[model samples]
Target: METLDKLFEDTLRDIYYAEKAILKNLPKMARKANSTELASAFETHIEETEGQVERLEQIFEMIGKSPRGKRCPAIDGLAEEAGEIMQEAKDDMVRDAGMLAAAQAVEHYEISRYGTLAAWAEKLGLSDAVPLLQATLEEEKLTDQKLTELAVSEINVEAGNAAEKNETNKPRAPKKVAAK
Candidate 1:
């Protein structure tokens, strides 16, 4: 049987580690994003992440655990994959599209973790942790919705047009010259 403390500590480690990785990754993501909207989104999230770190510290203090981060290999891999997408994407709109997708991936991870933590906090009767984690979770969800809105409202259409143009520009096989 796992003690509540162990579960809570593990959850704290997961979020703490994820936030640290996010701090490193968001700047690169902002750089890669094409649209002002996308760039702003990344930049805003960077600020939010800083606040999240502070909140985590408060949670740690409440829990009697010194604030610390454990290694989050999952986020490391996800950030690497997003970087590769940025490198491979050609057009500005296409890159923005990829950026939105990557951002959503990150948001989903955060939502899942935060949701779990909130549930665990409630189960463990850690009322204080519940509100703290819930706040972060709400932000994660809102960010995800903004990314989706960006994708559907503009980025996807622009990328689609750019892709179509590239397809049209490709040299058609030399039209069969009628060998009279």
Candidate 2:
């Protein structure tokens, strides 16, 4: 059986790797975002991610382990999908909406992973890890909320309006073809 320290170390490394991976990917995501608000959110989160990395290092110190990461394939795959979504989206608002969806996916994953880690920490009596994970979980939730707010207030509505404008701009088929 894995010791409590081992499980805690494993989870910490998982999140550390995930955070580093996000640091690499977020700049690209921020660049691809259509709304300034979305871009700004990504930018802000990138900064938060940097701090999260530092916090993970602190956790490593608390646990008396070297600060390092195990490869997090989950975050890698999610980042890949986010890149693909940006490439495939048709227009600015659609792209922004897609970005929101991708960001939300990331947030949800982090929430689940952190929540599990927090529970495990508490179960194992790793009091130090619980607060760190909880803090990260809260940040992820807040990021998701901000993205949802952006989607409702701007991106989705803009996409709808753009669709309506496109429809209005299209030339209607002439009625005289029946005579021929």
Candidate 3:
């Protein structure tokens, strides 16, 4: 039977890959964000992600394992979909909304993963790693909450207004050029 330590190590590698992938992708998300607040949020999270990566490295040291990443397909797919959102959204406000949604998806994924890792660490009696995992978990939750606030307070309303304006200004189908 695979031991809990083995499972923990496997999960650590998964999140290590996820954090590295997020570090790579956050800059693009920041550049594409339409709202100043959204862009700043992405930039700030990049720093936080860097710290999270360092924490993962620390966890590897505590566990006597070399810090390395395993391919995490979930994060890869999420990042890919975020790219698609940028391409598909024509309106700036709507694009910002999409970016926020994409960011939340990432945060939610991290929160879930970190929460699981923390639980596993605790169960495995890896007392030292538990605090580190919990710290990242809390940060992910806070980031998710911030995205929620931004969406409700600004981005969603702006997107709705933009969509409304687009509908209002839509050119009427060239009045049926009735064939003579």
lDDT winner among the candidates? 3
Better of 1 and 3 by lDDT: 3
- The lowest-lDDT stretch of 10 consecutive residues in candidate 1 is 1-10
Q: Count backbone overlaps in model 1.
A: 0
lDDT of 3 by residue, 1-180 (tens): 289899899999999999999999999989999899999999999999999999999999999999999999999999999999999999999999998999899999999999999999999999999999999999999999999999999999999999999989988776666798
List ranges where model 1 is wrong by over 4 Å. Answer: 173-180
For model 2, residues 125-180, the per-residue Cα lDDT tens digits are 87987898789888888888988888889988988887888889999887775665
Off by over 4 Å in 2: 166-180
Residue 176 deviation, candidate 2, in Å?
Answer: 18
Q: Deviation in angstroms for 30 in model 3?
A: 0.6
**Judged by TM-score, which candidate is best?**
3
Clashes of each: 0, 0, 0
TM-score of 3: 0.93
